[model samples]
Target: MRRTAISTTVLALTFLAVPATAQAQTQYTGTNAPIKVTLTVQGPDGLLFKGKVRTKGHDVTPATGGTHTCDGTNAGANPSPVPTPTAALDDAARVNGFTWDGTWYASFDDYLVESVKGVKSDATAYWNISVNGTSIPVGGCQFKLNAKDTVAFTWTTL
Candidate 1:
């Protein structure tokens, strides 16, 4: 009779511990956590496009470090590189039906922003990138993303 009681107690404890362990293991990591990126396209007049893009399903990770750093991830299952700023623009375009055009430079995969919402970069002003008001040292294609990042592409001489 004592053996039966001990067995039942042990089973109950095992059942209780399983859920706790599972929850801890399955908790959200950078891979599964929801990420939000705010994007803005500016022209000489002021703002052209601004919005937030969020994804919770895809695995997103921050870049290690440096001027060439930008958030990157695979597309679904493909191993191809996708930069955070580029992804943000793509997300905004998909969400709002906004059209954006860019030109890729050499073999670096760097993108030069040409136009957004019909505003073209002219001779006097060129499109430039900034994050949270600070100019990005790297090109858009190389910029890595962190969660809730603010990415801006402005057309100005400055």
Candidate 2:
């Protein structure tokens, strides 16, 4: 009878301990943290620029929405922001010597697309930004990033 009592007590304690262990596992440990986002620049001809930049981990929260700030600019479309792609290029500038003249943003080492010309003028290719194959409403500065998000810049002709 005593042995049975001891076994019963151990079983009950084991059951109780299982819940605690499970709860600890569920708590966020920041694993798989977003270290960088993939940046792909493409043109009508073919792939132009391909690179990766470390994510700043700044304002990664989705709740911040349109409130995130970048280089003294706010989110939303007064002029339509391409924040994610722009931000990636900015990061690239610091890390990879990338340069931009208006819509043209690329690393000089590769000089893949040469210069992206014009904005609203006819017969000019413009740079378009997208994340995971979907265009974002905001620009790079305001665009929040998750771990390993893909940011793409495509040059399209008018």
Candidate 3:
């Protein structure tokens, strides 16, 4: 009879402990955590342009020209052609701690430039969305016509 009572008590304690353990496990599911990120882009003359981008949802913004703003969704429209550098060596120093070569040029369109190491030209440009720094690989966003002479691109977190 004593053994039976002890077994019963042990079973009850185990049942009580199970729920507490399960509850602790559920708290770490991480379903409500926010994602963090950083973005960077390089231009001519060591001009490093950086922006804080969020990945919560879709967002769109206007494009910029070298000097003055342009019209229509396509900012590349007849933009004042800036002289492209003869060699990558004559470009500005890499911005945001990344080293790059060659003269950088800005288009009427919005693009991102990614930094790489070892390669002669460690900078590459994306059409719509570009990865500028070392961070999560967010996909590229495309440019759309917002209004007359206004174009925008939207990036979203997946």
**TM-score, prediction 3:** 0.22
Per-model TM-score versus the true fold: 0.60, 0.48, 0.22
Q: Indicate the TM-score of model 1.
A: 0.60
Please estimate how well model 1 matches the true structure, expressed as its whole-model Cα lDDT. 0.53
Q: Is candidate 1 or candidate 2 better by lDDT?
A: 1
Report every candidate's CA lDDT. Answer: 0.53, 0.44, 0.24
lDDT of 2 by residue, 1-158 (tens): 65345433432332234444433432232322335778876757777567778745232211112323332123222223222445565566546654443321111101112233221212344455667887544334434545577987776553
- Expressed as tens digits, the lDDT of each residue in 1-158 for candidate 3 is 65345433432332234454432322221121222334333333332434332232122221221221112122232122221110011121222343432211233132232222222222122122222221212112211111111111112121
How many residue pairs collide in each prediction?
6, 8, 7
Q: Model 3: runs farther than 4 Å from truth?
A: 1-34, 50-53, 64-139, 142-158
Tens-place lDDT per residue, model 1, 90-145, is 56765787766655433333445566777765544556677778755444554455
Please list all clashing residue pairs in model 1, or write none if there are none: 69-144, 70-143, 70-144, 71-143, 71-144, 71-145
Query: Which stretches of model 2 miss by more than 4 angstroms?
Result: 1-34, 57-73, 76-83, 103-123
- On TM-score, the stronger of 1 and 3 is 1
Candidate 3 accuracy as lDDT:
0.24
Clashes of 2: 8
Error in Å for residue 36 of model 1 = 0.4
